[model samples]
Target: MASIGPNEIFFLLQGLKWTVALTLIGFIGGGVFGLLVALARTADHKLARRITAGYIAVFQGTPLLMQLFVVYYGVALIGLDIDAWLAVAIAFTLHASAFLGEIWRGGIQAVPKGQTEAAKALGLHYPSIMKDVILPQAFKIALPATIGFLVQLIKGTSLAAIVGFVELSRAGQIVSNQTFRPLTVFALVGLIYFLICWPLSLWGARQEARLQTASR
Candidate 1:
């Protein structure tokens, strides 16, 4: 068996790079879609609200691992070829959209009713009210939760390994198999994940605290 060495370490770092890249793709794509989901959830139209609610429920209620499986394998079964990276990206984006949408919906609803009323009094349309007055404030309210969800999304990228994406967890598996040192390989992997996630967790907590203090 090969000993853990610079080569293995470099491989792990490369995997980390992919992990970060995947996280960003999921976040940016999800953010765009999630904004629409949030808007639909809060729309005046009951049908829009119900449809978005069902979308959120389906994604949120399902296991992310299963979702990844369906996206990665199920698509191919339908005669559509897709790369593992694309499949994983699609899965993560869908999962993140559902979660982030729900989080932002809460933020939107938490905005003071009087503010919406005041916007209406000023002859503002629904779009203008939300765009100018409601969304900005809702974003602030949702910032902490959003960051917390981002941290989750970062860790969740590990699941991409199941679909043959060589993320951090998969890299560790490879190194462990070659080095015959599962403990050492996984310990390092866990540490790397901690280092990446702990700061974001702390930042989220700090943001929550600040919001609480401001509200007082």
Candidate 2:
């Protein structure tokens, strides 16, 4: 068995970089689409609500690994050559969108009905009410849940390895194979993941606590 060295460590760090990149891509892309989904879910029209609800259900109901497989391989069957990076990005974005949309929808609903009524009473249009009044409060309410989801998204990036994406988990696998050190390699991998996620989890908890205190 080969000894673990700086080279293995560096390679793992490289994988960590891609993992962070994928997480960011997923979170940012998801956040944009998710906001729209949240709005649609809470819309006045039944059609819009139904459509977005269906969108959320399909994504949330399915496994993310399946989603990645469909995006990575399904496109190839149709003669579209997609890169693993792009495919994983798309899958994660869609996955994150469904989850974050639901989180934000709850936030939007949590705002007092009086707030929307007051805005409407002031001759505000739907867009104006949401943009100026409802969204700000909803954003604050959703921040903790959003961060918690972000931690999940970070760990979920490991699934990209299934699609041949070279991420942190994949890197650990490669190193473990080369060095014949599965335990050491995976221990480091777990440590890195913990380092990345634990703080966010703590922060989310703290925010939740603060929100509760504020509400009380």
Per TM-score, the best of the predicted structures is 2
CA deviation > 4 Å runs, candidate 2: none
Superposition TM-score, candidate 2 onto the true structure: 0.98
Q: Rate the local accuracy (lDDT) of all candidates.
A: 0.95, 0.96
Off by over 4 Å in 1: none
Listed per model in order, the count of residue pairs whose N, CA or C atoms clash below 3 Å is: 0, 0
Q: Could you tell me every candidate's TM-score relative to the true structure?
A: 0.97, 0.98
Tell how far residue 184 is off in model 1, in angstroms.
Answer: 1.2
- Encode model 2's per-residue lDDT on 65-174: one tens digit a residue: 99999999999999999899999999999999999999999999999999999999999999899999999999999999999999999999999999899999999999
lDDT of 1 by residue, 74-172 (tens): 999899999999999999999999999999999999999999999999999998999999999999999999999999999999999988999999999
lDDT (0-100) at residue 210 of candidate 2? Answer: 98
Per-residue error (Å), model 1, residue 173: 0.4
